[model samples]
Target: MKTICGLDCCGACDRKEACGGCLKTNGRPFGGTCVAAEWMKKGGKDEFLRLKNNLIDEINSLGIENLQIADLNLLNGFYVNLEFTLPSGQSVKFLEDKNIYWGNQVEIPESDRCYGLVADDSFLLVCEYGCGGADPQIVMFQRRQAGTEIKKQNLV
Candidate 1:
């Protein structure tokens, strides 16, 4: 099986040895829960798709220039997690290396950089990075407002 998130699991992942793939690991690859797998397992594929589509809508509505998102794929945290330097000079990573989240990549129109977007049920993270994900910089990180949570009851 590719993935419970309805996306190909082996597309571009580099942690297959550690992850054993989502299906082989029973949805808990890397010894942690994948938000996409958990949601899809709990509420079914259609519900999970709704949640993902809703998130895409939310990201688009942010009015970020050149960030018109089309879809969010199931991304392993280890692949998309990049350390970001804050204004205070402290660097931090907002994602767990073992968890899975919904994310996408959008290239800047006139630059060599690309925008990386990662989101779970609680927050939205936007970042820019160079080729091979070098020099990642945080563009924005926002806590998803109230009433936007996607749980079992919220799936409908």
Candidate 2:
């Protein structure tokens, strides 16, 4: 029996049977204290802007269909970031990133974790500047050095 746009985050949201998510309320989300909402207002938007630009730059440098980004799976008390993607039956996942977190439980391992992009090259990509507690960072090589420095974790 959840109200408030059915997302249960808003204290006074009354939009029944519908939720605008990040698009509604001017990218403000539904709740005032909502992590995603607060993040967008504070600095997440700017981070995303940078990531978009970086992704564009990466695409420009590596060609549109030459590279692929790896997927991430997160888990909290109640299955956060469930990797249940409806397969598109394609060879590559491309730039498809689904980040779903809420700051309740945050545990990111630096070396032992699934990579952000396809692990084919000698260099590993890391989101040097993470956007939010939930959003994925597209910026790579901000702190990590080039070459086969960090070992890749097999997320099979």
Candidate 3:
């Protein structure tokens, strides 16, 4: 596939035949471990999927009626957000809690659902909740270009 910055390394890498691709190689096409790839490799995608799916379930349970996909943010726990506009025209925001035990909830004002997406890129998250009004939905996506430099660290 492509690097985090969206470089078509598979097409240009001389070892594509042996390596398969960066996604498969964990971004270590030539050598050295890529931290970001490592994070995703070591159960990160699974965690992300769990959170995303859980969000869909929680939203559907709200029964808020006609809640439309107003906005979404897929940041790590510290910055996750999902917003919906209620039938009443008020906004509803679901924010991720820093406390691992607490999970997410509808708390912030609907107007606060303004976190930006990647603008132009493939959608990684596509969720459709059964809100029973105009098919409320949220699509979270990201566009990675060769210039989209990425850095990964242990954090701890």
Candidate 4:
């Protein structure tokens, strides 16, 4: 079992049997490109690390209380594709089910709930939810401004 980004995701993942692995599929695990692996393949580790660190800084700058993001790991889209109810009374999911993303889970200070942070090259999403992502509420959803590459500057 090999990994594109050197993370032991395949060993820890429950879907390994069905998904094979990132290395086996050339980063297209589960029929979707893994963001971390794709970035690593294109730019090597340093560039990917820079992108991850920059994204962390961008997420932290949002000023959401106690939502500091330390590190982001490769995450399956379906795992974080939480449904959010809009102010217009419509429930929606913002992420593609088969896509991969960089995300982190930050536990809100002194609370049982947690903040779920998910991002791609195009957007940043923050949501709050109870145990097991139950009763989720969208805290923030912002898209990257046009022509602003995530590696070059702030996301929004």
Q: Which scores higher on TM-score, 2 or 4? A: 4
By the TM-score metric, which is better: model 1 or model 2? 1
**Candidate 2 lDDT over residue span 7-119, tens digit each:** 33433435412334444544333232232333334444554344333443443354323233322221111222222222463332222122222312123455222323321
Q: Can you list the residue pairs that collide in candidate 1?
A: none
- Model 3, residue 67: distance off in Å is 1.8
**Model 1, residue 154: displacement in angstroms?**
14
Residue-level lDDT tens digits of model 1 in 1-156: 487667676667766776788888778999977888887877777778777778888999988899998887878888888988888999889998888888899999999999999988778899999999999998899997665555564444
The list of candidate 1 runs beyond 4 A from truth reads: 11-14, 151-156
Q: Rank the candidates by TM-score, best first.
A: 4, 1, 3, 2
lDDT of 3: 0.37
Runs of candidate 3 with Cα error greater than 4 angstroms are 1-43, 68-71, 75-156
lDDT, residue 39, model 1: 77
Shift in Å, residue 49, candidate 2: 2.1
lDDT of each: 0.83, 0.31, 0.37, 0.83
Per-model TM-score on C-alpha atoms: 0.86, 0.22, 0.23, 0.88
- By TM-score, who's the top model here? 4
Distance from true location, Cα of 52 in model 2, Å: 1.8
Q: Which segments of model 2 are wrong by more than 4 Å?
A: 1-17, 23-45, 64-156
Model 3: number of clashes? Answer: 2
Q: Using lDDT as the measure, name the better of candidate 3 and candidate 4.
A: 4
